[model samples]
Target: MDIHDHNRRAWDRAAAAGERWSAPVSPEVIAAARRGDWAIRLTPDRDVPREWFGDLAGARVLGLASGGGQQCPVLAAAGARVVSFDASEGQLARDREVAEREGLELELVRGDMADLGVFEDGGFDLVWHPVSNVFAPDVLPVWRECQRVLRPGGRLLAGFMSPAYYLFDFERAMATGECVAIHPAPYSDLHSLDAAAREKLVAAGELLEYGHSLEDQIGGQLRAGFRLEAFFDDHWSGGPEALDALMPTSHATLARKPEAAT
Candidate 1:
């Protein structure tokens, strides 16, 4: 399966349906951000610490898979030269909508997160990635590409589902409020789900998610030459899953590319 193409269509449908993550931000949010009262999330509820961004004034930021018109517009309002990149046209359109609505400058690009070939090496000071990468089948390439696009000392602020979140039968847990361990880490909807279930998902236009292991999600950043800086755990806000109430199902990380050797 062409996961990129499939997920793009699914996300486009989700955007059209006004899914939570696909919805655009309000003008008030943009206005506030312009006044330097801006906050963006790498996870569900916890705002990414402002210090993680240093000073946004004139920072070159790539909103990698962050094209829901949420973070990119805020970053632009906060004085960053922002590029909103994603695979889904519907998702990118949300950012474009807000950009037009607020007269904010944002470069919108549609592309896979794992292959950031459109961007030049060391082009961005920060890559703001949220939880969308769960749609990608592999995450190591995503980390490597993020590392490749960031300049020395550039930061990567990312959020992802913990591998543990994939171990459960989420559908069952949501329906019965019981955490039933069924799958392993590094799970794939394509391979993990039964044929009938996969067909139902495809028919419903839902996202095909992947559960990457910590080795690929976090350790991959270290393997790609980024020095881990800060980490935090977060939970889904008002989530339906049983585990959402028991423990954190998501995580955020701050990493920085090493300074250039003299």
Candidate 2:
């Protein structure tokens, strides 16, 4: 099965089902953003530091894999020229819904995150990516594409699940709160789950996730020429309750492409 196409359909179902991430931001939120009182998250709970964005006024921002009308609209309200790119048409529709309602201008593009060839090289000043990379089977290409599209000294703000979060049997933990370590890092629902289990997930229209390691999540950015600047941890309120209380299951990072030599 094609992971990208399958995940796209899964996310479309998720949007239609009113998944929390699929919910669009309110007009009030956009109003606050215009008044310089806006905050957005890369992780689940913690707001990304405002300093990370500096003055968004006129900044060329790419909302990478970030549709569903959450971050991009707010950034646009904050004066950034924003483009939102995602694979799911439903997700992009939410962004458009908000854009139309709030009178915000947004460039919405739908495609695989790893293949950002639609965007020109050094075309953006910032890439705001939330915790959606888990849906991608490979992240190195995504990182490379992010680096390529960013101007020198541009920032890449990204969030992702902690590698260890996938070690447990999530189904068992959610039902019984028993965090049985059944999987390893770099896990994939396609290869990690048995045929019966995988079929059940697909039948239910659930997202097929990948557990990418730190080497691919963080180190991949460095390998792609981003310099790590700041980082933070956040917990998912919707995740297994036992594990959510134990430790942070996700992280956000601030990395920058090096300035060109004079």
Candidate 3:
């Protein structure tokens, strides 16, 4: 199927879904990442702390597929200048209203993730990709452009679903565990999401139709000219082990481009 049609449908679904506009963290199968205690999992890097940003002040940051402009406020609050892009006009409009009410500002661009030439080369100091790429059956093209627009020595931060998620889900049980191969150390493309699975997820209250693994998470960044720096595996959910067990699985990766590498 054509990718544009896929995204257009996605935009429609996400806008009508009450979940995206309503909460900071889902009450089920997920915990807040920007919140929560340290130690059930990894702590934020001293550098990536959500607090005051002596570092991000005046630095330009790009938020990819920045739905609802959630992180845009965090970046702007920290003093980083931010530009966010999303395919959904309704979602962006909701974000703009929130920003206006909060007295914060974010530049919202409407575009498909696959093409980002609206921004210049070496333009941003930081590129933020969070919980967004899972929508892409393919992440390489989007990532390549992310690399292109990042200045030499700039940073790329990615928050993506971990491959481990597939193991516990019934997808593995039906395959008699053969589907378990989706998660592995040092990897790339997670399983692709067909439209049926997408529909099921939407029915299940998930705004997104797919999930990705560590390989797709970390490897894609590297392939886009980013060198892996640090990785955080979040197992920290605010609730007890039941919902916590199904809590989102993810890796927060920090990568950088070498100032002199071609």
Q: Evaluated with TM-score, which candidate comes out highest?
A: 2
User: What would the per-residue lDDT of candidate 2 be over residues 54-142, giving only the tens digit for each residue?
Assistant: 77999999999889978899999999999999999999999999999999999999999999999899999999999999999999999
Compose the digit string of candidate 3's lDDT tens values, residues 57-175: 68898877765635565566556688878777766765575567556667899888878989999999988776566567667787788889988988877666665554343455344
Instruction: Quote the positional error of residue 145 for candidate 1 in Å.
Output: 0.8
User: What tens digits encode model 1's per-residue C-alpha lDDT throughout 1-262?
Assistant: 7889988998898889888888899999999999889888998889999999988899999999987878899999999999999999999999999999999999999999999999999999999999988999889999999999999999999999888888888878878999988986678898888899989988887789998889988889999999999999999866755788888989999999999999
Best by lDDT: 2
TM match of model 2 to true structure: 0.98
Task: Tell me the lDDT of model 3 at 259.
Answer: 95
TM-score, candidate number 3: 0.70
TM-score of 1: 0.97
| Runs off by more than 4 Å, candidate 2 | none
Candidates in order, TM-scores: namely 0.97, 0.98, 0.70
